[model samples]
Target: MREVDHIEQLVGKLLLLVTPLEDRRLHTDLHNFTHQLSCDRISYSAAALFHIDRSLLTSCIAAIAISIYLVILVEFGLPSLTTSVNNAYGVPNLSEISSYFVCIVMNMYFFVIYLFDIDSTLQGPQKTHTLLSLSLWTGLMVLRLVILAYSSEMVVQEASRTQRLVTKLQMLPVPASSGCQEELLLFEEQLARSPLHYSAAGFFALDLSLLKSFVAAVTTYLVILVQFQIPDTNKE
Candidate 1:
């Protein structure tokens, strides 16, 4: 990524000013920097994952951000087409539970970050934006992302279970004379070759892993944003 290269150059210059360093040292120094570059590129590729239509991912992100900053900070929940997890017959989705669990973690993250005195740095008139308002807005945003991600992930999980069943059937001892063997083999092979995972135009899989990466990206950026917003003196 362009930003990655720029950061590497900046770091190299800083190191050079401290002491003389070899070219090899510079090349090997920032392993995590290179890793971050790879992650950034992959995240950019998966940005448009929530929608398949021809809409900009940046616009989608901006909508969520606007909801948090303008709407939820003043109000609470934004109206959207969300499902109530069916509390039926001692059963529902484990994915929904996963989302709920992560939502709790995000809730903790908000409170933990605010322990740095975010409220005291208030710009007078902006004093209305209390800790509760900020946390509520951010927690809602986290819920929005986690809920949708896990819901979409259900499709991929079902397909995997079906594939595993097919695999088990194929592995069973069957007659060599039966014509069904060839069909089972073909189906199993096809499933293996193409694998039934949903994606936004084949960019990446819309599974639980996507949820993991999505949350990670949001958390990382949120930390960076908060760090910049709070002044050094306040942080002290």
Candidate 2:
């Protein structure tokens, strides 16, 4: 994808910019310089990782904002015929729809970045701990994506079912108001008890809790990226 290429190029440029001396040097200088470059690269790589992770957070925030907008539209504006029909079928407000969309997009973004990070780690020299951390993070992200997808699908299915029930109610010669009310309440309770709902909530909580880990990982990656020169131990 274009976005992936762009990010790779940006990271490459950043590493190049931060790299130290390139000229061939005495053995001592080379050794010391190599060590310095490695240290610096680690820091730079960590910073770059932080930036990328922040982007994900920003995406989440954007989705939340859209959901809020939808809620406002549904609650306060002049009700359109389409909205009325949707409401009759128990279609969720704009916020719920927006939330689902945002979750899907974010999940995809996380997947891409996880792959990129894994590839980078594989292609370059990385410590055992770094590799392990990246692997765990990637796994967690994948799990989150799966959970999000499942949750969104469940919500959509529930919405469809509610719509059908409402339509059937509308067709009755004498409206079964009491029955409809009881059915709606049961539906709401079922939704609350759904595994998908719990999974979504858990993933959301996990992601929020991971902010600190994300920051640390990005910091480590940046450090690895920027420092390139080999160092000399004898000179020291």
Candidate 3:
């Protein structure tokens, strides 16, 4: 379908922007990165039943019900009678166990909420477009968040290693302390300029938030489109 094609094109462009590649090495490394993020966004959007355009919410209730049932089943399993014997000594109640399970389920539910909200915001007035811009936006945000988390972990590890190296250098019996001072100064300058030394978490979060706002603007446009649809018969 033309609509499908358009949607695909849009998604491809958005993905390219999210993880732009210049060199072959970086391109190869990031190949799976965009794909994974896209998949996650699609999965989350599907779960929310937001793929349907202009369809009544009730139309997807059955699918939503099945999904909820599956969630419940995974959250709570059958209790073993043999375990009841251990319960005689002391065992957690089903309610307590279910409560913890419900908490996890609720968190998952919120994640789904966040994904849908982000998606709806991104997808503006393009009923002819089937690919779902909101979904793509959600994917980008999630990818950015993941990158921030990973970068933070790397920063922590590198800082610890640098600290250990400095400690070792201090302990070394240097005959000419001047050489050591120069080496330390050079190292400090390198650290200041190094991308690895910079904390990207704040920038990452800010970028994601801006993406969300952009999506929201698109979503508003889409809402207006839906409100003023052209009459099919044009009888009036």
The TM-scores of all predictions, comma-separated, are 0.39, 0.24, 0.24
Q: Deviation in angstroms for 194 in model 2?
A: 24
Point out the higher-scoring one by lDDT: 1 or 2. Answer: 1
lDDT of 2 by residue, 143-204 (tens): 55445445545665665675567456445442232243444444444434432222222233
What's model 1's TM-score?
Answer: 0.39
Stretches of candidate 3 off by over 4 Å are 1-133, 177-236
Measure candidate 2: CA RMSD: 34.3
Clashes of 2: 34
Candidate 2 stretches with Cα past 4 Å from truth are: 1-128, 170-236
Per-model RMSD to reference: 28.8, 34.3, 35.5
Question: In order, what lDDT does every prediction score?
Answer: 0.53, 0.43, 0.43
Q: The CA-based lDDT of model 1 is what?
A: 0.53
Clashes within 3 Å, all models in order: 0, 34, 2
- What C-alpha lDDT, on a 0 to 100 scale, does residue 215 get in candidate 1? 62
Candidate 3 residues 46-158, lDDT tens each?
44535434343554554355445434432332123223323442223233323433443333333343344432433444521333444454455446544644554565467
